[model samples]
Target chain A: EAGVAQSPRYKIIEKRQSVAFWCNPISGHATLYWYQQILGQGPKLLIQFQNNGVVDDSQLPKDRFSAERLKGVDSTLKIQPAKLEDSAVYLCASVTSPAADTQYFGPGTRLTVL
Target chain B: DQQVKQNSPSLSVQEGRISILNCDYTNSMFDYFLWYKKYPAEGPTFLISISSIKDKNEDGRFTVFLNKSAKHLSLHIVPSQPGDSAVYFCAARADDYKLSFGAGTTVTVRA
Candidate 1:
């Protein structure tokens, strides 16, 4: 079976610019997630969606970051007025069920803000 | 306050030897633990997982041991191969569906 898919494997933008990342979860998956991984650190959960509804986004930066999964199959994460500290790999993952423990991850979009 | 921690930044082991990675967690609510392996440019792939009720789980060459009393867990790769070299991350999950991850440990299997 195909795994989670993400667009624009890499991205570069200047500080204060805006950037967006896309994710397509595995077929029939019910849960999707977005995470940020800074250098030398593990992925940090940014947001989570169960179907078209958000399950958790407490860690998301409301002032600068936003995400949506309109149809429950694909999702997008956006960062406006990007900061230098936002230069990190944005990862997308999905699971077959909310109770399932394993999460399949995508290659991730490596964003570099200069 | 980091809930999960992988204290060793990296580890090196010879091929045919054993590679052990350790992780600790401060949260008692975490009932499920998992280990993921990641290459340089790709995302992490699930390796093995052990529930809190079980002290050990093994699959092929990889094994995971959990100690609920100490709030510690470990991953063991026997007869380490070059292909096993990668960053290893330990994650803990509760019923809330949120996963807390460690900083990760880089393992280098030498031939």
Candidate 2:
């Protein structure tokens, strides 16, 4: 019963630079989500994946942000030409199902864009 | 559009006292509500939750009350302790599977 795992606990990058974050959901979890948490603000959903397919990504910045859950176990979120406004903690969470999803969150990657 | 709102930015309560956090939502479609607590660096952990059909749900020292008509909900912590000091966030989920979160309220329990 391992929890959700995320890589690169912290990251520092310059505006316009490209960066990527990784996530590993809990075993047997069917739903994976990526969220952006700005300082002093709650997490905002960026994308969600049910297995290897995307369930929702309406809030994602299509021009620069992208994510993929290739094997349905691990996922990655990328931001190219990152903006200063993109400096925030990126969190990954997983759930077993839509009905009983309690959402186990990872430690998150804190990205600082200068 | 900021569907969920946590008015109080922060609260400080003496140990052994009660700590209450409030949240309001504008969407009626949201049927499930949850409360999560987060420390400085760690991820948020689930605290308690109450469905729309239920007015109140309690677990140990934590309790959640939901008001569907007013689109408001609250979390109450009794006998607050230092360990209970953290940022509390209210989240609402609809049948569509999206969770809308509040801005978060920081609670400080001085022991």
lDDT by candidate, in order shown: 0.95, 0.94
Candidate 1, overall lDDT?
Answer: 0.95
Worst 10 residues of 1 chain A by lDDT: A95-104
- What tens digits encode model 1's per-residue C-alpha lDDT throughout B54-100? 99999999999999999999999998999999999999999886888
lDDT (Cα, tens digit) per residue for candidate 2, span B1-111: 999999999999999999999999999999999999999888999989888899999999999999899999999999899999999999999998688899999999997
Which regions of candidate 2 fall more than 4 Å away from where they truly are?
Answer: none
Task: Kindly report which residue stretches of model 1 are placed more than 4 angstroms away from their true locations once superposed.
Answer: none
Q: Name the TM-score of candidate 1.
A: 0.99
**What local lDDT does model 1 show for residue B108?**
94
Q: What is the lDDT of residue B56 in candidate 1?
A: 100
Error of 1 at A68 (Å): 0.8
Reference contacts preserved by each model? 0.82, 0.71
